[model samples]
Each structure stands twice: as structure tokens, then as C-alpha cells.
Target: MSFYFNIATDKTVTADQILEALGRPEVSVDDNKMIFHIPGKSLRGACVYHSDEGYEVGVNAFTPKTDARLTRDVAAAIAWLTGASVVPEDSEDSFSPEYIADYGGEDWVAERFDEAYFLARRPDDAAEGGPLSVAGYKRTFAVTPDMFEQDAGSLEDAIRAVMQVGIDLQTLDDREDIFAASLMSFTPPAAPPQSTLRRMFGLSKPVSNVREPYTAFFIGPDVRTLTPYNETSDPFYVHLSVDQKAVFRLPADDFFAYAEAAGARAYGAQVYDITISQADHAKLMQQAEPA
Candidate 1:
């Protein structure tokens, strides 16, 4: 899930014009794209693009469940950059009731079922090595709508829950023995049949359709990051069925340190900010400590 707003205007806006409007002299301006460095935001800058229609601005941060103020700020900045009144064209419902209803309450039993589905069908991870590898263990823990309404009295509460889940899941994945056992028990489905013509051309390969378990940390105004495990060393790392959807594997100790820091959460194991309660944070910290 991502949050972005596009405005169509009477006049075409150039990238430089947008940058000047943003009032950041250090912003990098390319042909039709401008990168705005938002302080206290992601290392990656908020991306803005100019087209004949107008300008489309997107925030680098996750969906603004807890704080949509940033998105609003970005929109206002873009409006100023374009020198035209905001004309909405294709705005996504960041917090639609339908989206919230999909959460279906905080059912750990359902989550376990979802985990079991992946374990039985998905291929093993080759990175961790051995027959019982940590290859294809994609698990997710989403902030349910019910969870949001109950635990998260406000947007801030919802964001905290999302961050807490990320820390908790990472800690759970640290158990290599448990991961190995789960992988060993499940048998991957046989690869699909290849056509005879494809076989002759050496293009016959079996493809598995199992998807990674994507934990939705934030449901409303969802945001995501896709990162490679080792870009330099393993640029073409292709072993699992769902390579693109795989989460980055980080060491448990390092992950714990990052997660424990106030307002920190993991999106694909990369640290991001979220406001969590001190009591809840401490409890997660205790669980994450060396056992």
C-alpha cells in the first residue's frame, strides 16, 4: 500500500519550478523528477515528478495512518511548486471503511493458518543453507481492523501496533531451529509441466506459485519497501518462488537494537519510525533479549 496525490493543472510545470516551490536549494533536479529530502524521513527522499498534465508527489514514508500531516505537507509543497490551485485527479482512499473491514479482527489462529499455508507450499530458502534452509519462510502479521479499533484508540495507537508487530515477528523469525523444523515438515508442490517445444529450446522450467506471507504493518495508507538481501554480492539471487516479495533477512541482534529504539519499526528489516507505548515497547524488548 502507498500514498500519492496527483494534481492536474492548466499549465505544464517543470521539475525546477517544483523544486523552487518546495524552497529546498539542495534538492536534486533531474529531467522531469525532483527529489526532496524530508528531515526525519526515510533515507530515500520523497519523489516528485512533472508531466504535461501536472505534478504527482509521493511521500517516502509508510501510509500515514498515525500522521497524515506529512502527506498534507507534501501536497501543500507541491501545490506551491506548481503555482496552480490543487486539482485532484485519481486520489486513492487511504483510510476507506472497506480497507479497514478487511482486517477481520486480531485472530492469531488465522495468522497461524496463513503461516501454515506458506510453510506447506512455499520453497525453502537457499541463503541459510542445508536441507532445512531458511529459504522460503515468508510470514506476515498485519494490524487487524478490530485490533486497530480496540488497541489503537486513535491513529497513533494503530501506528504503534504496526511497529510492535514488526519487532515481534522479527524476533520470532530469529529462531532458526523453529524455522528449520517448519521448512522440513512441508513438501513443496511439484513444478508445472513444460511444453515439448519449450523443452527442445531449453526454455522448459517448472514454476511454483506460492507467495510470501506479507505482514501488513499498517493497513490504512499502506507503505512498503522492496530491498535485495545482498545487492552487490547476490545481484541475481533467484532461488525462492516469490523472489520479489521476499523480506530482507537481518540478524536478530541488530534487528532488536533498532526495534527497541523509540519510534522505530522494521519495513523489510529496515528501520522506520512509529510511536509505540512504553509499556508495550518494554515488553517486546524483554522478549527480544537474549534467552
Candidate 2:
């Protein structure tokens, strides 16, 4: 199923203004309505129309295929343009396994189901000195079995519930343990048999033998900050750093290529590209563990 969100604001905005906010050119504009399209991304089309209550900005279709962060970015942009709070539409209930399978791949959705089941079955209170009770208080959390049923709505609700709990348990200063747990559970897809070219290029090495993939969290910069770098004439690559030491330079095209090749997926509120096998992921997790 597709997703949708609405922005209700009292500020006056025009079609051109909306397009400008999205950094897209207006495709068509009537007296009361304007349409814009994003060429290649999940955000396909959007329309801004005048309304009595306020201006309404609606997206064409948003689904698992769409970048999850795009919704929030769009809402923020609309709010900025109209000077009003953008009320996002909640279509989480409408998300189904069938839709996710159709758009995001069956294996991807199945893994989520497995994770939900695992989390649901875990005990609310851990054993003494266990991870959950380290802070000296018993933690209570459980997911109902109904969430794991072979239905779309239940699965969606269960996923959302689990994600919400995970988010709530996270602290700003600490590492995201919930996200690490999810990463540890991932099983990489079986790679194709090495071909002559792959053998020549030594493409069969374990991911650990290659450059270790690191998670770079980008905050403080809005979407607009990337606009100049994204321009076709002067596109720039991403340079990553840790503790002021330059780690690597990621070519713009290679970023998506690695993700697609490795079946890398993003998790949590912040975008994270998990580009390593379960073993490698576990290794990273161990490194990040408190001494």
C-alpha cells in the first residue's frame, strides 16, 4: 500500500514557493493547484493546493520503497515555506507485508517478521546483571503474538510498536543498542558464484578483509545543504572522518552501488547503511561495547 502525509498550515504559499522549497521545478500550475515531480527518487510527485483550513501539501505515493527520512524532510520544507506546522499523515497501519515484499523484497520483509517475533518472545525482565537491568531497574517490554500473524496490518503494527520501544529506550549520548541488535540479526544474501572477472579482481574476500564499512551519522545539515553538491555540473563526493582524521572518500555513485550489491539496508531514525555480513556487523558491535 502507498503512504501519504498532509501539511496543514495557515501561512500563504504558492505553487512556485512549494517547488522552490523542494528544489524541484514546477511541472504544471493552475490557479489553485500546482504539481511537481522528483525525477528518480521515491518521492515521485507532489501537489500543493489552496484550502479553506489552510494550504494542503500531498504526496503522490510513499511506501517502503521511499526513503523514510524523505517524509520528514518534505514536511519540514513545507513548514518553512508556509510558516506553519506540517502535520504528517500516518499510514503505518496501512503498511502490509505484501506491500513490503512487493516493493522492498520478500527476504527483507521476512527478516523484519523474524525480528519482530524474536523481540516479542523475549522476557520483559532480564536475569540479574543482564543488559536490560544494568541501570538497576527492571525493564518491561513485550510484543504480542498477534503482531506476528501472517497478515499485513498486524505485522505493520508489531514492527512499529517494536521500533517505537527501541527508539524510546535510546539515549542521545550512548550508542544505539536497539539498532545494533537489529544489525546483528541481519543475514546477508548469498552471493553469486565467483566468475572469472570476480576471481581476477579478488572479489571473493570476506568483507572483513576489505575496508571495514563504518556508520557515519549526518546531523545539523538540512537537505538544502546538499543541493549545491548534488548539482549535475559540480557534483561532489562524500568524505568521511572520525576524530578529525579522514577515513575515506566515498564516490557518490559507489555509495548506492555498494548498498545494492551487498543488500545493505538502513535502520533507525537516522540513515545507516549496513554494508557488512553478520559476522562483520557483530565485530563492529563488539568494538563499540563498553569496557
Candidate 3:
């Protein structure tokens, strides 16, 4: 099987242009993606290195029926292919044995077809037995395109054709059996305040009652800003102050929306207790009642 690499980059240049940029020959570009034929006789299986946002790097595979998810196996394979350091702590070594036991086995696949194919096609000799790590190969070099034909037969020529696009290379780690590319770039838009907090903790803010002020709280790290939800509203972000004081600038009047949506038990919602460090609490108190 022939190995190919498809890079979905953050640029609009064609494959030929990428080749030209990289000063390589024998590569074809179809729109944004560039496919390359890697060197090696036996076509090893493919892997995927994906980030939270941005492009996903898929290894060339003999068939598309492969899982090729961002997992440990994929990370290891990509590290081997790219000559990047596949840190032991980034692959299967990072997974706890007890955690694996909870899920039946470490390499267990839910799909029968996947299980069978992986077992048969896995590169047995290539498998790293000890703590997995990425090793460097000398032959690998960054390349650009040249005035080469669309169809190049030589593997070296083809690899040289695969230009490095603007896809930021993040830390390469293995998740389960696939390689995960933790892309360093590609930032998504920030969500709304209530939604953001809800998603983070999977909980809702407590309602503000006349008897008790709704404690809008945030603890830990530098507090960016507590801007009002609206332009007209006062800066009511008085949950905690920089001095770690628990302050309530505004009363809590809303509740049940998030709790209802989260499907939290009645008892669970009632007994909700969020703990913070003494230092943080003091900071809030200082902010709550300024001299």
C-alpha cells in the first residue's frame, strides 16, 4: 500500500503552488488539500492528527474504511512519519491502566470491522513496545515545489513536492489508539457569559432573592473583567473581588433555567456547594466592600 498525506492548510494556494513554495517536484494539488505519496515499501495504516479548531492532518491510507481517529496509535504513526518527537507521555503511556480496565481494555474498539482490520493490518514490527516516543529520521527534509509534472513516480520526488502549508503544528499527542494534533492556533469566538460558565461547570447560577444577594462568583487566576451583561446595566460582576472578598453587587433573581436544562436532581441542585481557596475568598471580600 502507498502512504499519502493530506494536509488541509490555512492558505488558498494550490498544491502546485505549495510545491513551488516548498521547492519540490512531483505533486498534484486539488484545491486546498495536498496529497503526497510517502516513501516505504509496505503501505502502513494511516492516522489523523486533529486540533480543537483548524485543519486536520490525515495520514495516507490504503483504504478509507480505517478509523484513523485522533488516538495514540495515530499519534505514534504520525510521529514516525514526520520525524517529530513522539513523547512517551503523549501516547499510550499517558493512559492509566486502571482507566483502561474501566473501559474493558486499552485497545478495545467498539466496532467489529475496526477491531478486525486493526488487528490484521497493524504494523506489528513497527509497534513501539516501551514507552512510545517520536524518533527522528535523517532523510526527511522540508521541501517546496519545482517545475515538475503533475504525476511523479518517485517517492522522494513526491515527498519533496509536499510543501509545508500554514497549518500551525501544535503538540502531537495520542488519544486512545489515534494520534491527536493539539493545534496551537485556530481560536474560536467566545461564547456568552452565562452559556460559557454553564458549559464549563455544567451547572447554572443560583437565583438572587431579596433575603440573599445572588453570589456571582469567579475564583482562580487573574480576573479579566466583570463587565455588565448589557451596556445600560451597572458593573454588577461583584461575586468576588481581587482581594478575595465574597461581594454581592447585584442580587440573584434567576435560577432553575440551567438546573432544569442540566437535568440535575432536586437534591443535587439544593446541596450545591462551590468551594474556593481562602486567598481567593479574601480577594472577593475586598472587592465586595471597597473602602
Candidate 4:
């Protein structure tokens, strides 16, 4: 729940680079292994390090507003300096400097969003058994952002991240057409790019996945859409008209309970737990046009 972000890169981040990134901020390297600091308390306010997982840099923020703003800027700087991707702990997707600058900072509430993926839109695309049995997309316990950040290795960890955006969204007008779907599925970090997904559909790759079915609650909404696939087994594609801000991760039992409580439109199976590759992501979410 604290403000911390990881900058993931192919090249390992070293103390030497940390000094360069922050104008050589006073850093105390522990055995030349890690640097842990707190930004404004006169202690190690910022922590920068690389672990065995991959070349990385971890940054934390300040006061809620200051925290979001400052931490975001620093993280973006490091990510770009190192050719890395920033992974905000609360977010379901990785983003760049401009990406974070765009829309939906933390604490942004979703309003007028009343639609449910608890029902099956396309049964053939759903999985066999489970609450989403007839759902077009299907649900999965693996590959949610919190699963990695919280070290959710067991059912308990998954359950901890569960949050039903019920009551809050329940009273809003029915805007199923504009709201991105709740269809979620898991994809590995090295999952195939959109080109491969085009092949999966026996077609061609998409020019953009950030086009429609966006979350209307925000000024510049987060795009949300699924890749080419009529069935559940196809290589899940990029999300169109959808962008990742932050999303909740839930356990199966509780997930089903909430879905039932939400009073589904129809029953079958549908939902998601997805994480796409950087190459595919870049292909999917288009960049802003020059001003």
C-alpha cells in the first residue's frame, strides 16, 4: 500500500548509475547491494537497487499529491535513462513518463460505471466450470499486478487483494456500451506480440488497441478491449480502447460471491487476469500525436 515503484530493464542498475540519475544524491549502499532511503525525512528517502530478477530500479514517493507527482517524475526519469519500464505497485500495467502523465493518477474514483462481466456474453470463449463457465473471457488466479507486488504465492495472497467496486458503481446509469469489459485473462511477460495474435486469428496485427470501450469516468479514459479470439484458448491479444490505471485482484470464492451479489445479467463465465509483453503493449497502446 505504500508508494513504491520498480524500474525494470534488461541491464542491471548499479549504484554508479543511481548517482548519475539523481545528481548523485547522498546514498548509502549496503554492501554495494542495495540502497534504501526515505525522500524528505533526512534519512535514505529514496531507494535504488537492482536484484536478481532483472536489471531494475525501485523508487518511492512523497505526500499524497506530492507523493504521486514527485515519485512519478523520478520513476519516469530513471525508466527513460535506463531504457526501462516503470511498474507502479497499484497499477495493473507498466507505463512510460507520458503514459503516467496522461490520465488517472492514484485515488481517481470510477464514477457512472455500471456494467458487469459476471455474465457470459460469448459462451464458446469461456472456460469449463467456475463462476465464469459461460463467460466469454474467463477468470484466472494468476498474473494480476498485486500477485507479483504482494508476493501472492497462495490462495490467501490472492484473497487479500480482492476489492468489489460494488455499491460505488451499482447506482450509476447502465453504460455497457461505453465501459470497457470486465473480461480478464492471464498472459505471460514473454507472451506473444500482436503479430502472433493476428496469426492466431488468421488475420493481421492491429494498428492500435487503445481505441474503444474505454472507461468513461475519466476525462481521457483508459482504453479497454480484447485481442482477436473467438475462443478462450487463443493467444489473448492487446487491450484496445483500454488503459491500465489500477485494478483489484481477487480470490475465486470471494470473486464468485461478489459476482452473484452483483446480480448478474446472465450466468456462464467471463473475466480476466492479464499481463501483456512490452513489445505487444507498445504495439497495442498508441503514442500521443505531436502537438
Residue 133 lDDT, candidate 2, scale 0-100: 14
Runs with alpha carbons beyond 4 Å of true place in candidate 3: 1-11, 30-33, 38-53, 60-291
Candidates by lDDT, descending order: 2, 1, 4, 3
lDDT tens readout by residue for model 1, 107-199: 421332233222223243422232111111123222223333344275455544443443334334343222211111122345467789998
- Find the 10 residues in a row with the least total lDDT in model 4: 109-118
Q: For candidate 2, give the lDDT.
A: 0.37
Displacement of residue 282 (Cα, Å) in model 3 is 92
Deviating ranges (above 4 Å) for candidate 4: 23-41, 55-74, 98-291
lDDT scores in order? 0.36, 0.37, 0.28, 0.35
Find the 10 residues in a row with the least total lDDT in model 3: 165-174
By TM-score, rank the candidates, best first: 1, 4, 2, 3
TM-score on alpha carbons, each prediction: 0.31, 0.26, 0.17, 0.27
lDDT of 3 by residue, 40-156 (tens): 211122233334322233332222222222122333333333334333221333223223223222233233123323322335453333111111111111111221224647533
Query: How high a TM-score does candidate 3 get?
Result: 0.17
Residue pairs that clash (backbone atoms under 3 angstroms), model 2:
none
Q: Write one digit per residue (lDDT tens) for candidate 4, span 227-262.
A: 111234332232322334532222333333433554
Backbone clashes for every candidate come to 6, 0, 37, 27
